[model samples]
Target chain A: MLENKDPNRTDLRELGEFGLIDHLTQGLTQSQPSTIKGVGDDAAVVDIGGKYLGITTDMLVEGVHFDLGYTPLKHLGYKAVVVNLSDVYAMNMQPTQVTVSLAVSNRFPLEALEELYSGIALASRIYGVDVVGGDTTSSNKGMILSITALGFGKPEKVAYRSGAKPNDLLVVSGDLGGAYLGLQVLKREHEVVKVNPAHQPDLGAYHYLVERQLKPEARKDVIALLEGLEVTPTSMIDISDGLSSEILHLCKSSGTGCRLYEDKIPLDPMVISTCEEFSLDATLVALSGGEDYELLFTIDQKDFPKVKGNPNLTVIGHMTDQGEGANLVSRSGSSIPLTAQGWNAFQGE
Target chain B: MLENKDPNRTDLRELGEFGLIDHLTQGLTQSQPSTIKGVGDDAAVVDIGGKYLGITTDMLVEGVHFDLGYTPLKHLGYKAVVVNLSDVYAMNMQPTQVTVSLAVSNRFPLEALEELYSGIALASRIYGVDVVGGDTTSSNKGMILSITALGFGKPEKVAYRSGAKPNDLLVVSGDLGGAYLGLQVLKREHEVVKVNPAHQPDLGAYHYLVERQLKPEARKDVIALLEGLEVTPTSMIDISDGLSSEILHLCKSSGTGCRLYEDKIPLDPMVISTCEEFSLDATLVALSGGEDYELLFTIDQKDFPKVKGNPNLTVIGHMTDQGEGANLVSRSGSSIPLTAQGWNAFQGE
Candidate 1:
């Protein structure tokens, strides 16, 4: 189903774990001030009524989620925290505390765990999040890392996935699908290297795409950018499961419709060219490719002017009547229905 | 290292996940009204300031913190939520919302997940906690689950782990060590079963002890019990890592020393006999045994009588000046130094 649906997709391990996270998190634009901090922290911290604190956590296990030969523990640790913070950041908050939980079999020695923690500690230090409380146990199988991030945010400022609105401008922070294409290039090269270890494939040619995949940064910049532009999204969600799914979520929650422009869909040049090389459709990749942690939000049209022309802010579309449905305008300007191809590992074998 | 610690501990699977969680959560008495809900829920729900809400979460993974063969996933999930609520309850707060994150390998079919979630869902329904949100994904190896619980309490009502005072009455809710002894019985049985497939041992003989090991419940009941008695603990923590380690945490955090009475320590008769049969000391099991989910706390000396005759509350010790070391009075009435036997999977191999 995934192959039939996401032909533009490449193997996840190609870009590697670290690179995939970095690529996905890049080009994000945050738009709230209560968000004293966003992604990159132990837990995104926010100023919640300037009183108490809130926290959330998530875990990712390899072989359970991704193949290890292709996934780096460092990137795995970093991405685990990133996913948790996305939820907190969605609430327009700042993250401060974190608890790192890791489970490994005898296969992982102290050094490997150290490598994973090195990334965790890097995230801790860089994001100013404290390692507060957690447990480390041995797994019966592969490696698993669970991260809980605590942040400070006002009760009123916290956003839920269910807050989109009709007539709200459908805005997305940063470019899309670069991470997906980056995976394609890395997977292609990985296959080549597997057949001939001596082959020094020049990934340099796809430097931008590769970097986007390897070091995906959470759109920490967007929080500041949105604040500077003086706009608050009426409803918001981080784009982890691709644009199509997220837009559908916003539309369903806000009881509205959306029409995305094919020409307006943001993409780096390398993504389009890479899609051509794979005979894949760039639009579909933009719609269904997962992993980008960019913010997809809906704002009151009145605030649209404030976000418009902002380098990081991309006005991908706008909300419409409920019956209009979620669709994308082709480059030639024909509307087409949108569908999600996000991985559901439990689906029929 | 584990050889001397919990070597006789049985595999968790023999108890199944549900049985294990029930063993850990038994007889935990509640003490506060704000804790409108406890242990059985998506999240433990608490009535904060009568209107506001507060939430927190934590996750545990096997291999990272436990061995599933010895740690039941049901008990793991139960303990996972218990530990997180212990944090908020430590704050004199109550849990209100919770989300559980789980990553499982195909090694576990949907039936396995159903059993795991049945406990979680049951806890939520029983405790009145809402399963507001959660993220589910595939794992590379075994299984890992993370739980986040949200709670609420008035600003003045919330208690912090650091709030214990010098000379506070160190009180424990419920008996200790059955969970540990239960482990021994299971291990013995497991060994027997492993050596002879045709042998169907008399499990009824160790029912009580096995139950404690297979299903440990949180001390949410103690929260209500304390409230009824009109007493409040100055500092609190749930027993997950053992009494010695937890008391030490309160002592160090509160900047005090402690004296625990071995004679006064509560132990189920089954625990005592099981330990003797296993050639292990019951006191050591009480000190190092984890998964009790009972509350270890301190209260004002004036409030002593309210608990003195209460079967649920035990005045096992008292806090002292930092100059005094953490010590335990032996059953023979001798003072012995206390040391943490908590498993350090990180200990250099």
Candidate 2:
């Protein structure tokens, strides 16, 4: 079925973008009836309970999204599912199914994809999310992964990004910056290995940081925590970009600002030491380093004591009025304007 | 900022799949009032409508998902959004918003991205959907598009793929197989051009076929069409993988079987000629060429004439008893078992 097309040939311009997607998604296996509409509409329609439904998507690519050389196809598959479920979790909903679409180059053997799907299946089982639909094709380059996780959520219980207010105590689950440090350490070790191919630097001590970088966890715990604590956040967002940038988003969307105490910022000891070792700013890591799957949320000051100082919870900051602006109050009583940096670095990259 | 290193690079075998994802999306940026939970959990939670919310993800890779050498990014983006929307739409609801994620290598310039987004933005507008959230990253090879569309449907209006019966008519909106033929023309042109670059083939003559390939529209119109016709498919699916595959899906899910008449298969006249010119079977194109984006659905037989001969619809087949099995009866009274040749081609590719 390779069809004998020149591997090094075929300009994408030969087919318009539409032609390409059509060719790729062609012969897709559309599997369900709740999929009232699929693939060829403004939005695919689903029927969940004939009353409410759910929708979410995640994107992954080679190089920018994943390093094929360093990353295993299986974990990449698992992470793809995890990423989409993160959104579903953010919505306070449960997922039922997912549609996966992939792009691959010939560099990947059939064995490679099976490995990827193995991880996808495992994650699907663990999360109770089914792989119901997807698209797959070859790429001219490395690879791409796009998966849409569909689930059921009563519309009345759905969450939006715009509901935080002043006096809401800002809290985050788990410590921060360990993942960033993990990246730093991994990058450093990778460099060393490149220069000295035989150097067997055992990074056993940095296992947590390294693992945090390679296998991220979506905070299914917070949902359990919220259930256990019997408390609900007024507003919330995920920590994908970084801490400071996320704060700026809450402020921008909720018509409120924040006041952060430098001393109060939670930092994993491993993250701190790694930052020091690299002469990198740990505070900046907490603020701008991306990819920590923790939850940043605001609860009424009334519920503060219920979770405050609890394990896995941190009093990182407090919400303020828009006029006050988002600021960080230092240990010395100085306040600095909060900056949004996550997206900027990406834009430059 | 391109900080790169990791000891794992020294021993590829040491870096397994799970380890890589952890490294890739670790230390995510945290923000927003609606995010109750994020990456480190079963699912992320957001606040919406004064209720807890959920989000999930999907990533569509290149070659594995679509053939960019044949697909235009514009339609690619539009279809990307459509694919995500289908999952949500399957719940029988209205889609409210979407976030598109894309990975493109330097092979694509800023202008190329602009075109892709233009289609996405246009589709968003057409669907009354908003581009509220997303991710954009770099890829090492081809362009990778991952789109997550967010939608809301009242619980009652949402439908599921699980609810069909033996008596259902198995209806579908819009004609079938034009997009398949569109590819035949495009591929022929591509081969012709490959052999002799100077030949300025008259593509204008193949308007409909070309349009079907490059500008395949989503059946957003079908949702409205059904509402106007005062008919709803008992079980529905979009014609993405070819009609036969979809019929089998409905049968398998409904625990029933189906029978269809070949003479009744839907096709535009141009598709007939195009298939003939290419020395391909028109039925084969309808059966497995895929990407029609039409709706394949089942309805009560009472609703037949109401939809039959509708400009956008065709009565190609019907549902049958479970023991009947899926079969296609030709105009000459010959019966053949329907085969899943369409989806099979991708696995080989």
Best by DockQ: 1
TM-score of chain A of each: 0.81, 0.82
Query: What local distance difference test score does each model get?
Result: 0.66, 0.65
Model 2 C-alpha lDDT per residue in residues B240-276, reported as the tens digit of each score: 6788877776777677877888888877888888778
TM-score of the first chain of model 2: 0.82
Candidate 2's error at A341, in angstroms?
Answer: 3.5
Kindly list the per-residue Cα lDDT of model 1 for residues A180-199, writing each as its tens digit.
77777878887887899888
- TM-score, candidate 2, is 0.72
* Residues A1-349 of candidate 2: C-alpha lDDT, one tens digit per residue: 1223455544444444333444433423433344433332112334444344556665676766566645667777887887777766665556656656666554555456667777787777777665543445556666678777655555554444457889888888887788778777777777898899888868798988876777777777876787589777777777777888878877876889899888888888888888888898888888888778787888889998799768888888899989999998987999999887663312333
Q: Write the per-residue lDDT of candidate 1 for residues B1-349, one digit (tens) a residue.
A: 2112343544433333323333433423343444444432222333434443444555566555555655555565555655676656655666655656777644554434555666665565555555444556666555677776656566655545566777888898778888777777767766887788777768687787666666666666778787788887787777777889888878876888889999888898878787888888888899998767688899989998888888888899998888887889887888887887654443432
